[model samples]
Target chain A: MSCDHLDLALASGLDLLGPDEAREFALHLPGCPACRAEVETSRLLLDALAFSAAAPAPRPALRRAILRRAQASRWRLPGPVAAVLLVALFCAALWLGATRFPVLPAVTRTASGYIIASLDPTARSPHAKGEVMLLPEAGHILVMADGLAPLRAGRVYEAWLLTRGGAHALGPLHLDGWGYAWLHARVPPGAFRGLLVSVEPARPGPGPSGSTVLATSGDAK
Target chain B: MQEADLPRRLARGDARALAELYDRFAPGVFSLALRRLEDAGAAEEVVQDVFFKIWHGRALFDATRGDLPAWIFAIARNTVYDQLRRRLRQSRLSEAQAAMLDLFATSGFEALEHLMAQEHIAELLAALTPEQRDLVRLVCVDGRTVAEAASLLSTPLGTAKSRLRAALARLRQTLATEVRAQ
Candidate 1:
């Protein structure tokens, strides 16, 4: 499998290969140990370049600026549409009040430490993605999501805390019509291996009774 | 979190995951920018821009495309280059001045490699003539083809290639020695 194609090897490593040459190299690479070694060396050399540089600390205020911008950009609706939506929301709140459905709590400050888990790709919605941030210090966990679809009539999206002990249901999420939700819940102190979000029938149970729609790490924490 | 899981956590929009990633790589990003732009304030701006774009586009990153570190450095390089271009446009320099400035813009790559090296490698690199150093920077660090580097240096391609190959061989020998020492 060895070849004297040093030029091709170096060019491939540097991303200087033309499309056809790149394709040809891709085919050649699988069987060529020497070329693979050249590419590896190139990578190592580039890494050494990074490692040898003098990294100065970033300005402290930059962090706040980034966070502020991110927060401002999330879930923004247009101005006039927002006003009409507000009126509609007021009417819906009154109707919900008469129906006796509980109100959802807002997300607050972050705790000192948290464990994060990414939702499983298979269980997630087509365009939806989510993460579970376990805030053990504040005794609450935050489930942040984007592109989550609304459940069918009488169906709800529920969160579950999966630990070595057992699966603890945290109740259904209250998503806005746009399919974004930031659900926060109070919990007793505990470690978790994973978190699961699922679509369940009306009046969800003490355990998951339907297919999972999103999930964190599959293994125990 | 494991290094392997950082990308997943980022894709899920976890702030803590971002904080961890920032803390680990920000220094390198900041330093690369600082070396390129030679201004702390500008470098900080590059860091912010790079990380913000990374967060917003986290899901788009394909692991198969390249490792996170390489992708990140590419961003840093491009951002700094854009900034340099902007400065050049703003200055309204003559063609000759602009070309000289461009050389300075490109020269940062080698200086960065030198700055990033440890004592032994740094010592070995220091032994190289300034032209040899620039050749290494242009070809290896900046990812330029040998022919392109020769054209930039206004040297014959054969001479540039031979010189660069020799410099790289020395660097490789030193690095191997360092590994043995470790």
Candidate 2:
């Protein structure tokens, strides 16, 4: 069924429609499949034409950075479900052990020195919540998270230690079956400002290159 | 490492498969990004994002939908749109320019048509008459409005519209056929 708005739809896809025509087409679009398909096909064709642009090789540093991150994540957790389960159990045991050993002076002294920061969800994942236990004296930062959406393929949950200097990657957070994950990383030396959990590529760039899923209000001094 | 096995190997978290994929598609990805973004650094970042997503999302690749290159370019297209959106958001543009961007903001749809079109962009352009191709280049690649393109080409507004409409219709029909054949 050819609509009178067909020309307007095609022009709209090419971004050639004037404001008045664009608004008119927008109103007509939801009701017209033929015009909608025309716009969709036009956009796809233009997207494909974009590929014909001059191809330049990426810098070597990018390749190295991506591979390095991927390799690090691969080695950090080698196996499948069994390995993840083992790591989860080990983390639980460590959390349990740390809490149970109250008499040890380092644990005791660090316990008082630790700053408990709430990892509040950002707009990206509103229902998600987490907490970060930053024990600077003990040289440890423990992250416990719940209600994280399962990551899309080619993505992972990464923790970052945000300082005035910059955001330093803590590591990838591997959640178990129940949508919960705990990450225990040695607190790197910095005047820590906050903690962030972002959905990053499995091979993320040098900084946090994804949406901030959970973060603390930058007061973790 | 056969091309056919790349998806499976990548899905299994094989770093080598990722390297291979990057080697194969990074240049095209970088080119597409650089063309859209016009900033080398941003383009490089897009390349990184594209490959990273490919590696992590390997499990999500459905061979039934299209081949690896198709999937890679689809991701690249979306990533470039993201970079463009980010740039627009960060830059202090005039209201008119911003409104113009708003018009083009709905340019994120991807399909098998793009994959088919990507492989045959030159051929597809060749299929159009010289005048139609020039009109397409002016309006599509150069990002000019149809009226502006008509003025530049010294063609009548009605003639330019008909030529462009016909040219686009041909390309769409050809690509749709290619998609169905696949």
B1-182, model 2: which lDDT tens digit per residue?
59779888887889999888777677777766765566788788777666655654454455665667766666676566544444454574444334334433432244353354354677888889999998987766655578999999999988898888788878777776777896
List model 1 lDDT by residue over A134-197, tens digit each: 4443344556565677777998888776655556666677564434554555445444445788
Candidate 2: residue A217 lDDT (0-100): 63
TM-score of 1: 0.39
Model 2 segments more than 4 A misplaced: A11-37, A52-54, A80-221, B34-38, B83-117, B120-126, B129-166, B176-182
Over 4 Å off in model 1, which ranges?
A1-11, A15-27, A47-64, A67-221, B1-129, B139-148, B157-173
- Write model 2 residue lDDT over A9-106, tens digit each, in one string: 65665655667887887788767777766676666576566555434467888888878766755544455753564455445334322222222211
lDDT of each: 0.56, 0.64
Clash pairs, candidate 1, are A52-B116, A52-B117, A53-B116, A193-A221
lDDT of 2 at B24: 67
DockQ scores of the candidates: 0.12, 0.21
**Model 2 complex DockQ against the native:** 0.21
**TM-score of chain B in each prediction:** 0.56, 0.63
